[model samples]
Every structure is written in structure tokens, then in C-alpha cells.
Target chain A: MMVVIWGVVKFIVLLVLLSVYVLFMTWFDRKVIARMQNRVGPKLIGFHGLWQPLADTIKSFWKEDSIPRGSYRFLFWLAPIIFTTCAFAISFVVPFAPPIKIAGGVLHFSVVNINVAVLFVFAFLGLASFGVLFAGIASGGSKYPYIGSQREGAQMISYEIILALTLLNPILMSQSLNFETIVAAQTHHLWYAFYQPVAFVCYLIAMFAVSAKVPFDLPEAESEICCGYFVEYSGMKMGLFPFAQYIVLLVMSAIMVLMFLGGWTGPFWSGGFIAGFIWYWVKVAFFVFLFTWAWGTLPRYRYDQLMDIGWKILLPISVLNIFWTGFALSAHLPFF
Target chain B: MTQIVFFILSLGTIIGALGTILCKNAYYSAMWMISTFVSMAGLFVMLNAPFVAMLQIIVYAGAIAILILFVMMLMDRRVLNNKERFNPQYFWGIILGVGLFSDLAVLAFKFRINITNAGKSLTLHGSNTKMVGDVLFKHYLFPFEIIAIILLIALIGAIVLTKKDEEEAR
Candidate 1:
């Protein structure tokens, strides 16, 4: 019973932390993008628009709720719910810091640490695409939204292969799927990124594609499909799509850090939980910033170019990298 | 708690399967099928096969269902609604259903249905993912390679079939 209570408490804390992170991340994204474009963004609200996301949330709540005619009302209501749930579900397995020794037992920073956590994260990612598909299908049989969902489905399938293959390099080297084990393995040797540079680069590129950020944001291409699957969504229903997206960005960034960046362990010193917690977030923040940075700098890839990059380039390279990593590990090659 | 979870998942699986068949819309049918897949994954997890459960979600609910949904999107609703109620395929469906039911019935009656340590050999010391990896790469290496080769052949065949002819392209 105590254990259950502790688990619930930890989950609530994580929820609060995630909400705060998302709120600030929106501000950070806007500010960074604005600076890149040589303009000030949301400066009037709080300190550099720190409170703007909160204001936006309140405003969205007050807006009139509208459902399109001929829409599947039940599914239209359920789509964002599914998306947001799956998005938050990915974070459940990501360890924020190393487990800390307490009075009676150890306390893990993550919500849950299942054995097949790597696969679990990817599974949720796959399931989240369903939410996008449902939104498109439930939107009164609209052409644009349907096209957007189709693009999302294709993009997800293409990039997921690359994402899985790239991450397999680290998993192979570590010989474990658990985040804690992977991070622990890194502590003993150099980070996987230093050895598996190919996988790291591929993962970085695939990360942008999987998260549907700029360059690969073809699913939600503003000019082309007009915000894609969520074109018919309005009010908080609309808000939920980006809400889920920001969480995905944070979770993917966290996974990248955990897998490749030697999660929570500082380069100079492997410190206590307090220091490790700070180190972990700092790394995660860099990746989060990188997402917005890419958003600001890069132009959207044409649909054909997106497919070409995912299939023709990234897929072959990642598959080869996996084979190379496996051979190197077995051969006891130096720096593996 | 375990019983409650099992009951919920089992109920969900039944409802999803029923919905898949009963839904008039192809899109809703696909969604219901996905729900069934997810519930089955939960059941797999309860059976201590987390790896298989995750694979089920990733492969079936994620990839295959999306492909089915895409195909269904191109289909006209008028054509779908105009379809005959009864079909010749029902004969095959009944045969398959009865065969599966009898197989399950025989297993239940003969084996007494207690299945502890059913997958012990496949999951010894390490987690099931590791055990599965060891089995695939070490014990069943040749079969694994053969499967990979078959998949590669299929992939190539798909490309060949889909590719535009040179004369048509010109």
C-alpha cells in the first residue's frame, strides 16, 4: 500500500513537472525562433513571455467549442485524448536521474522502469500516430485533413525504421534495453555517441523527422495541408494536438540524452542525485533548444525529399551502422 | 488487482473484436481492430511476455493497421454501403472459426489449462528481450537469417511491382 502511494505521489509530481516544462518550452521555442528572425517575441507578458503559455491556455478554454457537421462526434472527442495519453505515456519510462538510495529502499526518478522500456517508448510513439489518423478520419470526411493524416502515417512509418535502427546501436553495445542499464554501461566506458557517431547523427536527423519538426513537418505543413490532421479541430481540442507534440519533443529529447549522451552523468564528475538531476535536465534542455533551433533555421523538406531522405539515405545507413556495431562489439574492437 | 486488470483487458478485447466486425465504416473497423490489438498486448504483458506485447503494439497496431487505414481511405463509402450483406467468404470464415474453437477446446480439456513457467526456456536469467535476442542470434541463427532473406525478397518484389515502367515514364 505504501509502495502504491509512493508511486502515485511520484506520478503526480512528474505530471506537475511536465506541465511546467511544457509551459516554459513554448515560451522558449517562441523566443528562440523570434531571436533568429530578429524580432522580440512575447516580451510584454511576464519576463520575455514566460507566462504567455498560461494566458494562451486560459484563452483557449474560454473559446467557443465547435464541432463540424457530419463529423464522428465520439471519435472526434476521443482523438486528442488518445494522442495526449500516448504522448505522456512515453515519459513514464524515461529516468530523469539515477536511482537515489533512501531510508528503506531505492527511489527511481522515472515513473516506471519496465524491462523493455526502449521498445515500450517506440510502441507508444506508433500508437500516437493513430490519434492523428483518427482526427483526420473523424473530421467530416474532409479532403485536406485526410491528406494530412495520410502524410503523417507515411512519415511515421518511414522514420520509425531509422529511429529504431539507430537506437539499436546503443542497445547492442549496452546489451540491455532498460534506460538505467544503458546509462550505467556508459558510465563504465565512453558514451555510445563517441563510438557510434553514425548512429548518433542518424538518430539526430530521424528525431527531427519523427517529431514532425521543421523540414519534416510535412504532416502539418501550414501552407500545403493547412495544419493537416487537426485542420477541423478547434478550441482545447486543437490545443491538445500541440500539447501532445510538445510532450513528444520533450520525451524524445530525454530518450536521446539517455541513450546517447550518458544520461545524468556529468563529464568532469559523476555526482550525487542533486547534481545528476541538474546535469540530466541541462542535457535535455540543449536538445530541446536544438529542436527549436532547427525549427528556426531550416526550410521544410518537400514531400518527395522527405521520403527520399528517410528511405534512400537514412534507412540504409542505419542498417549498416547496426551491422558494423554488432561486428565491432563481438570482435572486441577498441573503443566499441 | 491482477484479476481486475485481466477482466478489464479481456472485456476490452471482446468489445474491440465485436466492434471491428460490426462497424459499418471501414475506418471505424480499422480503429476497433487496433483497439483489439492493444488489448491483446495488455493480455500478453499480463502473461509475462512484455517483449511480445510491445512487438504486437509496434508491428500490428502501429504499422499494419496504418497501412490498412490508408487503403481504406481510398475506398468510396457509397461502394462500401452498397455491398451485398451475405458473401461466399462466410463459408470459409465458419470453417476457420470452428477449427480454431475445437483446437482451443482440445487444449483446455486435455492440458487442464494451468500454464506456469510456459516460457521459462525462452526467458532464463536476463530479461525476455535479452533471452529472445540470444535465442534468435545463437540458437536459431539459421532460421532467423532465412526469415530475413524472405523479408528482403518480399521487399524487392514489392518495389518491382510498384515501379513505373520505362516506356510509361517517358
Candidate 2:
């Protein structure tokens, strides 16, 4: 009975924590990016701009909700929901920390501890592209939006192949797709990054492209495409797209840390929820910082150049990484 | 709680499937197709086959639907909607679809009635991903290899068909 109550409490707590984290991250990004460009971010709104994200949310809520004439009503309404859902869905299987043992029960770190967590992550990542596709095509015959959605769709599909292939390197090495098991495998063995550096690099590149971050954000080239597929969206509807994007950024970092950088484990890490959670999130934060740094520093890739790298460069490297991992295992190699 | 989830997902799946055919715009139809695929993935999760569910969404909903959406976008949008949503074959199509559904229903009920237990029974024996991989590699290796060979031929055929001759281009 207490366990059931704990489960409910945990779910609510996690949901609230995620939302608060999202809020803080918006502020953090603004501050970081501003410092990068020698300007103040949002310090005027509150102490260290703590309430800026909340204020922005309220402002967006009051903006005019306009739908393009001749727009397909169902799809226009559904796109943001799908996008948000897809972003949050992949986090369901991700274990947050070590399972904490209570008086009568155990508290697992994830919402759903499914056996196929890795596959689940990739699947939802793929599905999320449809939200971009629908948003583009259902925008009442907008030309630029159409172009944007096409690019988003093409880029997602192309990068996904390499993403899955590179993912298999860790999966093949660990011999499990379950995140919990994978983490445990890394707990015993060294971190996957040390063992499979090629896979790590391939995955890192694929991750940027798949998430449509800077240097790979061809779908929404704001200057040329006027923000691409999401041009027609306005108000809080527009708000949801970026919210979903932020959530995905957080989730992707967590996944990267989990798969390659040793999930929830650090030097001399003992079994305690607080310590494990801190280590896990600290690593996740480092990766998120890397993403933002790249976003601030890098220029967007040209269209053909993006596709060329995805297919010609990343594809071959990812495939060879798999083969290398396989050979290493078969030869009973001593080193990582 | 499980029953409620099942009800919602099944309703969504049915509506999505119908919406694909019923929508006037081709873009809407493709979007509905994605909805259907996503709902099917949810059902797969309920059935304890997360691997199959994920694969289903990734391939059908994500990749293929996007390809269709791209094609739909390329064509003139003005002609995508039909003046009359119903076609001459609509009646026959419904009849045939219902007949096929009923036939499958009959077969399933006849064969699997004894195995039926709870109204919402979902069973699983082992690791769904591992089991699938093992079966394909062990039991279905020959058929899988043959299919791979056929896919290779199709790839070659596609290149040959789409190739442009240098003389013709000049």
C-alpha cells in the first residue's frame, strides 16, 4: 500500500521536476548564449533571470492564436501535441538513478523499465519527425513551410539509419538493449566511450543531426526559410514546439551519457540515490553544455552537404564501427 | 487503468485508420496514417513486444509516411482534394473490407477460443527482442537470406531503371 502511494508520489514528483528543469534550462541557455556573445541574457526579469521563463510562458499564453486560412484544422491542432508527446515519450524508459530501497519496497529510477529501452528511444525520435511533417504540409499551402518540412523529414530519416547503427555498437558490446542492464554492464566494464570511441564519435555526430540542433538545423533555417516548417504556428502553439525541442535536448543528452559515458556511475560511486542521481545529471549537464556551445559557435550546414555527410561519411563510419566491435569481441582482445 | 488505456488506444487506432481514407486532403490522410501507426505501436507495448512496437513506428509511421508526405507536397495541392469524397468503388470496398475482417475474426475465434481468459489478457514469456532475433537467425535464416538476395536484385534494378545515359543527356 505504501509502495503504491510512493509510486504515485514519484510520478508526480518527476513530472514536476522535469517541468521545473525545463524552466531553469531556458534561463540557463539564454544566460550562457548571451555571455558567449558579450551581452546580458535575461537578468532584468528577476534575480539572475530566474522568473524569465515563467514570465515568457505567461506572455505566450496571452498572444493571439491564429490559424492559417484553408489550414487542415485537425492536423494544425495535433502537430504540437504529437511533437510534445514524442519528446516526453522516450524518457519513459530512461532510468534516472540507482533504485532506492525502502522499508518494504524498491523505487526504480525509470517510469517504465522495459527490456527494449534503446529501441524505444530511437523509435520515438523517428516518430517525432512526423510532427514536423504534418505541421509543414497542413500550413494552408505555404511554400516555405513545405520546403522546411521536407528537409526535416529527409534529414531525420537519413540520420536515423546511422543513429541506429551506431547505437548497435553499445548494444552489441553490452549484449542488452535494456537501459538498466546496459548501465550495469558499463558498471562492470569500462565506459562505452573508452571501449568504442568510433561508435561514440559516430553517435555524437548523428545525435546532433537527428535532433536538428545547430550545424544540422537545415529544416528551420530562419534567415532563408523564415523558420521553415513552423512558420505558420503562433502563440502558445509556437511555444510548444520550442518546449518540445528543449525537452528533446535534455533527453538526448541523458541518453548519450547513459549509452557512452557511463550512466549514473562515477569514480568511487557507492549505491545511494542522491549520489547516483547527482553523478548522472552532472554528466548529462556536461553533454548539454556541449550541445549549447556548438549551437552558439557553429554555422548551419548546406543542404547537400548535410545529406552528403550523413550518407557518405557517417554511414560508412558507423557500419565500420559495428564491424570493429564485432572483430574485437571475436578475437578476444585484451584492451578496451 | 489498463482497460482505460486499451480503450483509448483502440479507439484512436480505428479512428486513425478511417481518417486516412476519409480525409479530403492527401496531407491529412498521411497524417492520419501516422496516428494509426503510433496507436498500433501503443498496442504493441500493451502486448509486451516493445521491440516490434518501436520498429513498427520507426519504419511505417516515421520513414514511409514522411516519404508519402514529401510526394504529396511535390504535387499541386489544388488537385489533392476530390469534389466528391465518395467514389464508385466505395460500396464494394467497404463490403470487401468487412468481409475480410469477419473471415479473420471467425478464424481467430474458432482456433484460439480455448486460450482466451481475461478480457484484457496480455501474455509474455521472455525477452521480446532477444526471442525475435534468435528465431530469425536460427529458424528463419534461409528465408531471411533469400529475402536479402531479392532486395539486392531490386536495388540493382532500381539503379538500372533510373540511370541516365550520357549520350541521351547531351
Candidate 3:
């Protein structure tokens, strides 16, 4: 009973922290993108728009929430709920820092430490796309939203293969699915990124594609499809999509740090839990910034082009990388 | 506590399955099917098969359900509304259902004692994923490789069929 209660308390703390982090990322993304475009962003709010996300949250709550008359109202209502739930679910397994010892027991930084953490992330990642697909269909069967959902379905199915295959290289090296074990394997030795650079690069590219970021944002291209899947959504309903997207972005970045960047453990230092926690977020923040930077600089790909790049380029490369990793391990090669 | 969670998940799975059959909209039916898949995954987790549960979610709820929804989305509403009074599939569906039930009944009767022993052995393993890996790669390597080859053949067949359609369109 005590263990269960402690777990609940830990999960609650993680939830609050995740919400605050999402808010900060929203503001950071806008500010960074604005600077890249040579324009000031959200300066009228609190302290160079540090509180912009909070203001936006309040404003969205006050605005009128509308459901299209022709839409499937139940699914319209359920879409964001499911999407947000799946997004937050991925956060449950993320090890924020190394385990810390207190008076008698050890305290883990993650909310829940499951053995199959990597597969758990992949499972929820797939379910999140389901919620987006549902949003497309439930939005009064509109043409643009329908098209957007089609793109999402196809894109997720393709990119997820590469995502799993790329991560398998790291999993092979570490010999464990738990995030902590993966990080522990890299603590003394080199990071898997150094050993499996091909897989690392491919995973980074697939990360953006899986999250539906700028270059692969065909699912919600505002200019082309008029905010695609959530076009009919208004107020907080619309806000929830981007909110969920940001959480997914954070989760993916954290996973990238965990898998490839030697999560929470910097190469230079051997500091304890507090430093590890800070290091984890610092690496995550850099990856988050990369997403926004790409958003500002890159152009969105056409639907066919997006599919071509995923299947033709990323798929073959990921497959070959997996084989190469397997061979290297069996042959007892250096670094691997 | 475990029993309570098991009860809730079982209820969800049954409700979702019924909803999938009864829902008028194809998309809504697909949603119910996905809900059913997820509930079954929860049940699998409770049964100490986290690896299988995750694979179930990733494959069934994630990939296959999305494909089903993708096809359903493009389908005309008129096509979904069947004018016939009878579903021809009901006969075969019932027959197959009864056959499956009888098969389960026979297995239950035959392996009632062995099932308990198997359950105990399952809990003794340190890691379910590693155990499954060993079984697949070492104990059942031939069958596993055969399944993989079959899946690969199906994939190539699908691509070849699709390529022909694209060329004809050109």
C-alpha cells in the first residue's frame, strides 16, 4: 500500500513538471523562431513573453468551444482527450535522472520504471497517431481534414518502422530495454551515438517525421490545408492538438537523449542526481530547439515526396544499419 | 487490487467489442475496435506479458487499426449502408465462433492442470522479454524464421501488386 501511494505521488509530481515544461517549450519555440525570422515574439506579455503560454492557456479557456454541426460529436470530444492522454503516457516511463539514495531507500526520477520502456514508448506513439486520425475523420468528413488524416496514417505507419529499427541498434548495444540500463551502459564507455552514428542520424530524422514536425508537417499544414486535421476545432479544442504535439515533441527529444545522447549523464562530469536531472533537461532542451530551428528554416514536403523520402531513403538505411550493428557485435569489432 | 484492475479491463474489452459490432459509423466502429485492442493489451500486461502487450498495441491498435480506418474513411457512406436484410457473413461467423469456443473448451479440459504449472513457471522467469527472445531464437528458431519468410513474401507480393496498378494508371 505504501509503495502504491509513493508511486502515485511520484507520478503526480512528474505530471506537474511535464505541464510546466510544455508551457516553457511553447514560449521558447515561438521566441526562437521569431528571432530567426528577425522579429520580436510575444514581448507584450510577462518579461519577454516568459508567461506567454500561461496567457494563451487562459485565453483559450475563455474562448467559445464549438463543435461542427455535421461532425460526430462524441469523437470530436474524445479526440483531444485521447491524444493528450497518450502524449502524457509516454512521459511516465522517461527516466528524468539517475536514481538517488536517501536515508534508507532509493528514489527513481521516473514516474514508473517498467522493463519494456522502449516498447512502451513506441506503443503510445502509435496510439497518439490514432487520436489524430480520429480527429480527421470526426471533423464533419471535411475534405482537407480527411486528406490530412490520410497523410498522418500513411506517414506514421512508414516512419514508425524506421524509428524502431534505428533504436534497435542502441538497444542491442545496451542489451536492455530500460532507460536507466541503457544510460548505465554508456556511463563509463562511449555513447551509442559514437558507435552507431548512422542509426543516430536516421533516428533524428525519423524523430521529426514521427512527431509531424516542420519538414513532415503534412498532417497539419496551416498554409495548404488550413490547419488540416483540426480545422473545425475551436478554442481549447484546437489548442489541445498543438498542446499534445508539444508534449510528444518533448517526449521524443527525451527519448533521443536517452537512446543516443547518454541521457542524464554528461561525459565530463560524474555528479549525482541533481546534476543528472539538469543534464537530462539540458540535452532535451537542445533537441527541442532543433525542432523549432528546423521549423523556421525548412520547407514542408509534398505528400508524395514525404512518403518517398521515408520509404526509399530512411527505410533502407535503417534496415542496413541494423544489419551492420548485428554484424559488428557478433564479430566483436571495436567501439561496438 | 489486481482482481479489481482485471475486472475493469475485462469489462472494457467486452463493452468495446460489442460497441464495435453495433456502431453505425464505420469510423466509430474502428475506434471501438482499437479500444478493444488496448483493453486486451492491458489484460496481457496483467498476465505478465508486457512484451506481448506492447506488440499487440503497436501492431493491432497502431498499424492495422489505422489501415482499417484509412480504408473506411475513403469508403462512400452509401456503400456502408447495406440494403439487404441478411448478412451472409453471419452464418460463417457463427460457425467459426462456435468452433473456436469448442476448441477452447477442449483445451481447457485437457490442460487444466498443465495450465496451472505453466502459470507458475511464467512468474519464475526474471524477464519476460528475454525469455521470449530465447524461445524464439534458440528453442523455436526454425518456426520463427519460417514465419518471418512468410511475412516477407506477403510484403513483396503486396508491393508487386501495387506497382502493377501504378504502372497501369500511368
Candidate 4:
């Protein structure tokens, strides 16, 4: 009963955190990008537009919802909900810290500590592609959205294998699929990043690909497809679409921290709940910052280039890394 | 609570299955199939198979379903126009489905299932993953290797079929 209650409380907290993160990330992206272009961004409403994300949220909520004629109404509406919910739910199993002793001596973490938490996160992330595909198809648009959806679907599917294989390296090192076990393993030795550099790089590339960031942002390729799959979306609908993207970003960063960064492991701090929480956030924020920085520095890849990097470069490397990790583990070598 | 979850799961799976057959557009059908896959996975979790449930979502719902959807898109079939013709087949499909369901129901009623009332909940034993791996590599080794070889052959065959045809056309 305590576990159930803790789960509910954690779910609520995580949802609120994700909602705020999504809103602010949008504002941050806009402001950062604008500054890069030597212009002030979102400076109108609140102190250099600090309140920009909130304002945008309100505007989206108030905007008239429009459904395209001949669109499949059920699927069109269902897409965003599935997309956002799956994005939100994966965080439930992810440990933000060591379990906390709460009222009545109930032990709790951010979410349920499933044994297969790592795999669950990947599985949920994989579901997000369906939302994009459904959104494109249900729009009943010309060939452009279809083309965009096709690209997005193919890109996601291809990158997903690499992501899983890259993740397998750390899982092999820890000899467990549980997120908590992976973190606990890291406390004894160096982080998995030291040994699995190839996997780390592959994961980083795949993360960018999955997030549809610069170079891999083929789904929303401007100049050619015009916002690509989301061209037809408007008002709160578009807001939901970007909201899902931010959630994906947060979840991906969180997973990266858990799998590679020795989640919540810091010097001088005992592996308590508060310590774990701080470490988890710090690592996630660093990665999020890295994602923003990459957005500024990197140019978008050509469609063919993006596909080539995914299939030709990252996929093979990840496969090789998996084998190497497996061999190292079997031979009792210090792989991590 | 379990019943409530089961109800929701069944509703989702049934609606998704119906949508797969009833929808005019192939893309929409594929989306519904994905929904069915995900909901079925939830059922698997409810049955205490979290690993299998995750695999179902990751492999089938994630990779395989999307692959099918992509192939459907690539084929560019005029799905909306063909709905009228496909409607007649649905009646036969439903009859066959009902017949199978009833047969399974009768079989299930006839069978006596013996379940041990273990006082303890199912817990994963230490090195369970290793045990599974050992079984796969030892007893099932030949079959595993054969499957890998078969997959490789099929992959090569596909590459030959697609690549050579494109070259010949060029």
C-alpha cells in the first residue's frame, strides 16, 4: 500500500517537473538561438521574456483548435495524448535517487523500480514515432506530410536498433537491466563511459537522431518540406507536438545519466535520496545543456547524409560495440 | 483494480483490432495495429511477464509494426477506394474469427489447469538471465545458429533481388 501511494506521489511530481521543463526548454531554445543570431529573443512580456514559455502555453490553450477536413478525427486527437503520455510514463521507473525513508518508514523513489527499467525506457521512447506518423497521416494533406512521416518513421526505426545496442554495452557491464543496479555498479568502479566510449558516441549520435535535432532534423526539414510532418498542425495541436519533443529530450537525457554517468554518484555525498536527486538533475541538466549547445554549433545534415550516418556509421559501430562488450564480459576483462 | 485494468486493456485491444480491419486507409490500420500491440503488452505485464511485455512493445510494436507501415506507404495502394470491395471479406473474416474463439473457449473449459498455490510472490532468482543464456547456448545452440544463418541468407537474397533489379532498370 505504501509502495502504491509512493508511486502515485512520484508520478504526480514527475509530471509537474516534466511540464515545467518542457515549457522552459522551449523558451530557452528560442532565446539561445536568437542570441546566437545576434538578436534579442522573447524580450517583451517578462524580464527579457523569462515568462515567455508560460505566455506561449496560455496562448496555445486559448487558440482555436482546427481539424483538417477529411481527417480521421479519432486518430488525430489520440496521437498527441499517446505521444506525451508515453514520454511522461517512462520516467516513472527511472531512479532520481536512492530510496527515501518517508512517513511511516515507507521507502520511496521517483517511480516504481522495475527490474527492466532500462528496457522500458527505450520501449516507451520507441512508441513516440507512432505519434508523428499518425499526426502526419491523419492530417489528410498533400504528399509533403506523408513524405515527412515516411522519413521520420524510417529514421526513428533505423536509429532505434543502434540506440538499443549502444545501451546494451552498459547493461552488459552491470550484468543487469535494472537502472538502480546499473547505478550501484558504477559506484564501485569508473563510469561505463570510460570503457564504452564507442557505445557512448553511438548513443549520443542516436540520441540526436531520435530527438530530430540539427543534422538529423530531417522530419522537420525547412526550405524543402516546410515544417515537414507538422506543417498542417496549428494552435494547441502544434504545442502538443513540441511538448512531446521536449519530453523526449528530458527522458533521453535522464536515461543517458542513469546508464552512463553513474546516476546520482557524487563525491562526499552518501547515496541518500537527496544526494541521488541532486546528482541525477545535475547530469541531466548538463546533457540538456549539451543538446542546446549542439543545436547552436551543428548544421543540419542532408537527408541522404542523415540516413547514411544512421545506417552506415552508427548502426555498425553499435553492433561492434555490443560484441566487444559481450566478449569482454565473458572473458572477465575490465570492460568498465 | 486488476479487473478495471483488464477491462481497459481489452477495450483498447478490441477497438484497435476492429480499427485495423475496418479502417479504409492502410496507414490508419497500421496505427491501430500499433495500439493493439501496446495494449496486449500491458496485458502481458498484468500477467507478471514484464520482460516479455517490454520485448513485445520494443520489438513488435516499435520495430516490426513501423516496418510494415513503411512498406504500406511505399506500396502506395489506393486504400480508401478499395474499402467497398474489402467489406464483403470482413463478414467471412468475422465468422471465422468467432468460430475460432468459440473453439478455444470450449477447449479452455474442458482443460483442467493445476496451479500451485505458492505462498511467496514470484521473484527473479539470482543469475536468472545467465541461466536463460546458458540454456540458449547449450541445449538450443544448434537451432539458434540455424536461425541466424537463415536470417543472413534471407537478408542477402533481399539485397540481391532489390539491388540487381534497380541496376538492370538503370
Each candidate: chain B TM-score = 0.82, 0.82, 0.76, 0.74
**Per-residue alpha-carbon lDDT of candidate 1 for residues A1-336, written as tens digits (9 for 90 to 100):** 887887788889988998888888888888898999999988887877788999999999999998999888888998999999999899888887789888998888888878899999999999999899899989988888888988989999999999999999999888889999899899998888899899999999999988898978988999898899999998899999988999999889999999999998888766788788889989998998898988999889999999999899989999888888879989999877
Model 4 pairs in collision: A215-A301
**What's the true lDDT of residue B69 in model 4?**
74
Name the runs in model 1 displaced over 4 angstroms.
B81-86, B106-126, B162-164, B168-170
Clashes of 4: 1
Candidate 4 reference-contact recovery: 0.74
Would you list the C-alpha lDDT of every candidate in the order shown?
A: 0.88, 0.84, 0.87, 0.80
Better structure of 1 and 2 per TM-score: 1
Each prediction's DockQ against the real complex: 0.75, 0.75, 0.79, 0.59
lDDT comparing candidate 1 with the true structure: 0.88
TM-score of chain A of each: 0.97, 0.95, 0.97, 0.93
**RMSD per model, one decimal:** 2.6, 2.6, 2.7, 3.3
**Any runs in candidate 4 off by more than 4 Å, and if so which?**
A101-108, A267-275, A334-336, B77-80, B83-99, B112-134, B165-167
lDDT of 4 at B67: 85
Off by over 4 Å in 3: B81-86, B95-126, B161-170
Cα deviation of A328, candidate 4, in Å: 1.7
DockQ winner: 3
Q: Select the stronger candidate by DockQ from 1 and 3.
A: 3
Identify the CAPRI category of the predicted complex in candidate 4: medium
TM-scores for candidates 1 onward, in order: 0.94, 0.92, 0.93, 0.90
